[model samples]
Target: MMEPAVCGEPTEPAAPPPLLAQLRAWLAAWLTDERTARELVDYGRVGHYTLALTRWVAIIGQLFTVLFVHFSIGIALPLVPLLAAIAASALVNLVLLWVLGWRARLSERAAAGMFVFDLAQLALLLGLTGGIQNPFVVLLLVPVGIAAGLLGRTFTATVTALGLLVASLLAADPLPLPWFTGGLVFPELYRFAAWAALSTAILLIAVYTYQFAEEARHRAEALAATRLALAREQELAALGGQAAAAAHMLGSPLGTIAVVAKELVNALPADHPLREEANEILDQVHRCREILKTLGPRRAGSEVDRLVRAPLSATLRDIADEFGRAGISTEVRVDSPDGTPEPCLALPPDIRHAIANLVDNAIQFATSRVDILVSSSHERLLVAIRDDGPGFSPDILDWIGEPYLSTRHDRGGLGLGIFIANTLLARTGGKLHFGNTGRGAEVRIEWPAGALERAVEEREHDGGHD
Candidate 1:
């Protein structure tokens, strides 16, 4: 049975939920409810409002071309009822902009609504100006293209479909063009423009959304890395506090036990077997007191950098011991090829957590045995974990450590274990490699000894300032 816990062993807490999961949940919520849609956009960016301003300019430019400039261009223009309708709609849009104000950012819903209104206004312009016969009808796609870049897929898709429907409807019935005397006809070219407008909306929306979403994903990944690093630092900070508290609280009980054991030794007869047991108890209590005394001041320090650093061998042993307590068949060994003494290494929370995660993964997949081997020289330090079980499948080998990509889904693997491990180790100047030993699976971690030492020092220096 696993014991409650032993003092001095570093505990690896569960990783925070993957950010990808949070993103997926938000996307689902936004797609279902208009209220939920308002939070998905980063309206703080100036570009969000710029798109709307550009739409206004385009609408105003189109109105000027039909109402005033057509006569100069020798296009036989005449103002119709559609011109009045377009002017009134444009006026409403201008008033809406004035109410929204330039300083305030539009919510996601309002932004989407703005694009929808642009589509409606453009559709009306197309019907009046000659429907598909007007070359500028292709401009109806502008709203959907903007939606693709600034809004979620559901909203973009809605706009794209609406644009397509408007194109189709315009092909069937369009009011007479004011520029034409009797109603000019260009059958073949108009038919082509209708098909072109529909196709262009779909294609441009796909291209723009894909480009923008990919950029957003990259930013999210960078933010996630910074978050993971901060979490490791906080966990270490918490551990130091807990360790000091444990030592402080246990000091008195251990003193009383030492006193009791000494008295018992004095009371027992010299020949009695119980005397030796009492003496052993006194010795143990004395050892415990010495340990507490040493731990007291180090643990008392407020900074994580001041916590006691262990040799690599001890760190591995602590991890193995914790797993061994859980009834897993685990062995830890330090191999010195040059027969030199192993270097004492600082066990920062990030390194400890990474190693422990790999060990846990090995235990889960192993049939019987898992071995953690540490070997180092003047140049390099290496830790290799091997397990006797089926190795990673070929399909997932290249994609290992990617979030949400797991082989053991049935066993509740979220596939984030390897990713967290790999990320943390990378920060410490370590490289993680995975492969099969023909018999099972193996993961090897290596670091240049000098680079790792410097990384540890830099981390301490930075953390101390924090």
Candidate 2:
């Protein structure tokens, strides 16, 4: 039928399907958001065994609940459809197990797909049994929670949206609740309340679980980085020891060769052809000795002390000089109790590396000058590094030695230097204090006076026994 247009009357446009509109928006957002794309691409995988075990538990529980309610309690449930849904889930699980094996790890997309399936299956079962009116409707939140903990943010959000959508649909026109007397009826307001409660719980639980799991993952990664740094320092120290041993072993033979060459040069006539060759041999032998000496002390008596130990003042001065040459005016000062010689410490590679890292950090932030102060007494040794520049940010000062805690984003550093230095210092019984001085940032490292020497001695003793 056709009607003539009226001048004062207007007709409304037809609205798009809600589901199609939502799907379009979701797709557009996923395609446009770079962070979400990266997360989905790089998210870690979940093991097959873990997924299978959880699914089996859920399936068994569902079967048991349906059987008990329909048979034992005599509730007139749609047993065939309920069992069919459960069997569908079980069949999918079996197919996955058979194809992928129990040891397989599901990729990010694969895991997300599996979770979506589980959510849909659970929603379907709820739709048949009475939707939000059924007590088992609470189980719908489980998959979303697990996804939030194991999957990326976008995936979690997607799962949550699906759960909300299903809950809303169930609220609209769910099948009657199974009961001994025909069917149990719930008020419309009560059903709405249940839907609202379930939706709120899903969001809250997902957020909490995601945050907790993310924190644990970050801590684990930081610890792994720390261990790698420490291991590298240990490897360098081991290499140094090997070089010292080689130098010690080679010194005697080189000395013997030098003596023989010198004697031959003296015994041969200057005009003899052998005389120049002998002199060349002696010169080469001298060069070899000099090279070995640079590696370590040639004499066994002083090898350990000369190669492994250095005065604390000298170490600080060396670190200061290194940074001083890099455009920063670095100064070092040493103080001790009256008439006491400066303490010499076993300069293990880790300790040296830690000290160097601190000095380098100071230089990086210093506007023009850096000051290094060393003080020693009978009981303790202390080192303080200060710089004239903008001090540490007050917000992060309390969390100073934690991994990846950095304020200098412009430098493209991961902020592991301080954490590595702090960790190594702690291992050697040193305590670090961080604060802001009047002009800039200040870091103080303190250790027992003899701790360095004792640690070295223990290591050497252990090595000998091994």
Candidate 2 on 10-51: residue-level lDDT in tens? 855667779856765554344334453433323444576788
Per-residue lDDT for 134-201 in model 1, tens only? 77776876777767777666666777788777887777766555453656656766676666756776
Question: Candidate 1 at residue 347, lDDT?
Answer: 66
Candidate 1's C-alpha lDDT?
0.71
User: lDDT at 320 for candidate 1?
Assistant: 68
The window of 10 residues in a row where model 1 has the poorest summed lDDT is 297-306
Local distance difference test, each candidate: 0.71, 0.80
User: Which candidate should be chosen as best, given lDDT against the real structure?
Assistant: 2
Residue 187 CA error for candidate 2 (Å)? 5.2
